[model samples]
Target: MTLSENGDLWCDIRTLHPAGNHPALFLDRDGTLIELVDYLSDPAAVVLIGSVLEDIWQANKDGHAVVIVTNQSGIGRGYYRWADFHAVQARLYDLLAAEDLVIDATYACPHPPPDAGGPAHSLYRKPAPGMLTRAADDLNLDLSRSRILGDSVSDLAAGKAAGLPVGILVSDGYGARDAEAARVLADDGFEVIRR
Candidate 1:
């Protein structure tokens, strides 16, 4: 069966039904939290980024919901299957849990590119506010206070489109190159920090 045959949206809630209207730190998986690996599908290859470990811990302590928003195009493109994705994610969760870092929720969009003859560009992919907006509604989060943290310009674009006030572009993955283009999105209270 194809990835789209399973569904278009993938959501996993780790919290025991968290109360709504909380501020969230919407994080990206690959290149943002973990080391960048092109279409990574192996659990053993997972490696956490040390730079944001403290920030994640602080967000939890500060009463912010730690959420992950990822685009797993590899799944839809036949590079990996859902089981592989779960295995990789389980590794990530295990590593974070070891540090006492809890993720409130996780969302993934398994839409393939147009070349795959599918509408992967629907509402849930990055650069579009679908996943973030859905997370806000599902978790009852306040978008105005939420922040998107990723290494791509798409993260900043999505945050701004979602009306989020902050977007952190880290130099972990593609941030160093995307930084120049992301500078323009840092207006009207939508702060874009290129680190």
Candidate 2:
């Protein structure tokens, strides 16, 4: 999937092979699937966390659609361009392809916070259900059986708002820092996976 010149998401719908209303594994890009690099734009900086790849591959083997739903505020913040994000995505796709793994779809929200002149509390950002709901609609996914994995509380919040069955916070990157806060999510039925 690629973002169009007008910043619209252009997914190759033909490539999506959902397994009959199967659940989706929504994932965050940085800190969750890859190394945490602030505003990463260079393809050379891309590094896959081995466990994430294994989990995604296993989910695919188990008949779950794997989709990457990320919040790319860097584009809105002027830290990087949309093309740069695509370049990194291209590298990521190549890497995953080499491993015989395919992500069903990818969605990114370039909008930043209202204080930064971006859309005010945009629904596309984390803690909102826009991206998840959009993907669910586009892919015919079963939200009631779906799960979301990330390293931040907002990721779980987004999944919760989207009515997904589960939200997992991996204990890597920002997870360690937010361990205490994650307890609240755990109380709310979120799972914390410690590395």
Please, what are the lDDT tens digits per residue for candidate 2 over residues 66-169? Answer: 88888888988899997888899889888888898888888888877677777775867887888898888888899888888889888888888888867888
Those runs of model 1 whose alpha carbons end farther than 4 Å from true positions after fitting are: 1-6, 16-20, 115-120
The residue pairs found clashing in candidate 1 are 21-140
> Residue 58 in candidate 1 has what lDDT?
91
Clashes per candidate (backbone, < 3 Å) = 1, 0
Candidate 1, 14-133: lDDT as tens digits: 774356688889998889999999899999999999998888999899888888989898987889988898889899999999999998888888876567755845787888888899
lDDT against true structure, model 2: 0.80
Q: How far off is residue 152 in model 1, in Å?
A: 0.1
Query: Clashes in candidate 1: how many?
Result: 1
Index of the highest-lDDT prediction: 1
